[model samples]
Target: MTSPQPAETRTQKRSAQTATLAEIAREAGVSAPTVSKVLNGRADVAPSTRARVEELLRTHGYRRRRAESTRSPLIDLVFHELESAWAMEVIRGVENVARDAGLSVVLSESAGRLTPGRTWADQVAARRPHGVILVLSGLDESQRALLTSRSIPFVVMDPAGDPGADVPSIGATNWQGGLAATRHLVDLGHTRIGAISGPTRMMCSRARVDGYRAALETAGLPVDPGLIVTGDFHHEAGYRQGLELLRRPDRPTAVFAGNDLQALGLYEAARELGLRIPHDLSVVGFDDLPVARWVGPPLTTVRQPLMEMAEAAARLVLDLGREDRSSTATRVELATSLEVRSSTAPPREGRDVAG
Candidate 1:
């Protein structure tokens, strides 16, 4: 009804031929792949090539299609095992972060019996997730190489040392936490401190013991060789260690367990020996999990920032596609707090507090 608009000025008229991306690239003297790479902001393209393609895109008024890009988004979360409640907390952290950033998580658990590393690697390679997050402390060299080799952005939680790869790491400072727990007991004048540690291969076990030693030295107390017991990080190990320590003519007045799970075992050992806590013996633990607070006497222990660490790990892996390495290869050490309860006190019956 209004005057017929000319073809050049008609906004409603259908154009038979929509411009294709390849035609635009041909006009810019570059391949269609270059235009696609630059338009998508993929990291695989070199700086010069990316720049050239971007310049052409701007000149040609090319725009990125958001609908297609946002259609398929997924991430991968890998762990040695997922049985513990604490681990579940970390998982929740990861899920919260990823979901907020418009992503869904695919989970994998490495059985961790012998070739779990290689098997996990093959499985991950087959899936090709946008990014990966690892929660295993015992990750082997080949597995690390595979991740880096594939140019996949990954993050590791609770890495022991070096991490030996380009991935970022997020975890609580296990060593410092142990030191804090032991130092608290040492300050309370419990000189004979016995420990129930985890597996030797685990960095957590080694770091925690190191903290125990550091506290003893700081207090100018001689580390007692007979009092130190190495048990699995289970309650049974704690019970066995407790039995051995209680049998000594000079028994430890306080015990520092590697984890809360082991601390429960130590409590059983005290019951077996007819010793009263903070009366005849004292006990402290690491990883102040939810159960630690509910346990008898409300276990005095060190707490790890499980949620915060998980969030940081998630961010590191999610932001990997960005040009800046701001979030990649980062190492964050969260602080630990010591929760004092009725489990510790100065030795009784004229037992000299080792200083």
Candidate 2:
């Protein structure tokens, strides 16, 4: 017989166009066979290991994958609106994860309705996507029930709460983050602190407000009802809330906002009123989103692990479709941190701290 070609050369050439198991293995710090086990949808791979492989592929952009279909990952990404910088970043994170795994995505809006059927569900069902990823604001029992009844895999990026605790959830640690923001303001020795909050329907809005109130109580100061103003958590809401607070004769010396967007608006509102930051009034905010640092007087706020949380949530939901593993809804909670910067300090010259 003629001399045979080298096995390694042949194997490498055959893999020229697609992401090979060896590539994933090296990225994941595992052997090629282990990569095969995961691609085969085997339960032998641990949850953490599976997450690592998925993350590596996602970040590295290893596409052209044609693994056996474990409920084809045609993902449906339902979002509120992509206009807001914060919302857009979350959607981007979700998309990055879905695309890297060689999956497709559908973007939908669940406006007015409690659930997505008329607005999104029916559309996603028609498309027959492998799974659904919801970035919902608030949902009632009827909406939650409808989603729960679906046999298709689903994950949620709550702008509010986990109405259906049974489904896997990934979101910023709003409560802790809020606390950190409030404490930063308090640390500067500003006690007569007020807060402008996001929509009440949002869990983050409520959690952040609660965190502010708790900080005051811990400092032995009664939470002032008059000092708290509620808003929609948008820039305009921030501007409007800022004006309301600024106009008051007994205005707050320090203010904490539910989000960075709102805080930036508040900053503008203060400037219009001839007030200087950290001098006339101190301000702190939650969600140290990308735009936070770029604004005038860099914001001191709480940072949500937005990208990492999105990836984790996406993987958890996708895993449900894999037949090789025991199908159960999983939950993963990520933490947040306080990022102090140029936007906070003590009261004006004559203003009493206790007031």
Clashes of each: 0, 2
Q: What's model 1's lDDT at 75?
A: 75
- Give model 2's TM-score versus the native structure: 0.74
Q: Write the per-residue lDDT of candidate 1 for residues 281-352, one digit (tens) a residue.
A: 888887778888787777888888787788888887766644455643476777778888777777786765
Residue pairs that clash (backbone atoms under 3 angstroms), model 2: 116-121, 160-203
RMSD of 1: 14.4
Clashing pairs in 1: none
Q: Candidate 2: lDDT over CA atoms?
A: 0.70
Q: Root-mean-square deviation of each candidate, in angstroms? A: 14.4, 15.9
TM-score of 1: 0.74
Best candidate (score: TM-score): 2
Model 2 worst lDDT run, 10 consecutive residues: 142-151
What tens-digit string does per-residue lDDT give for candidate 2 at 1-355? 1244577865664564355558779878999877655444456788799668655543443442322443445787766655567767777777888889888777776653335554354344334456677775444443343333233567777546544444566777777777778788777777778899887877768887888888888878888898899998789999999999888887888889888888988998999999888778788887778887988788888888777777776787777655564645465558989888888876656684423
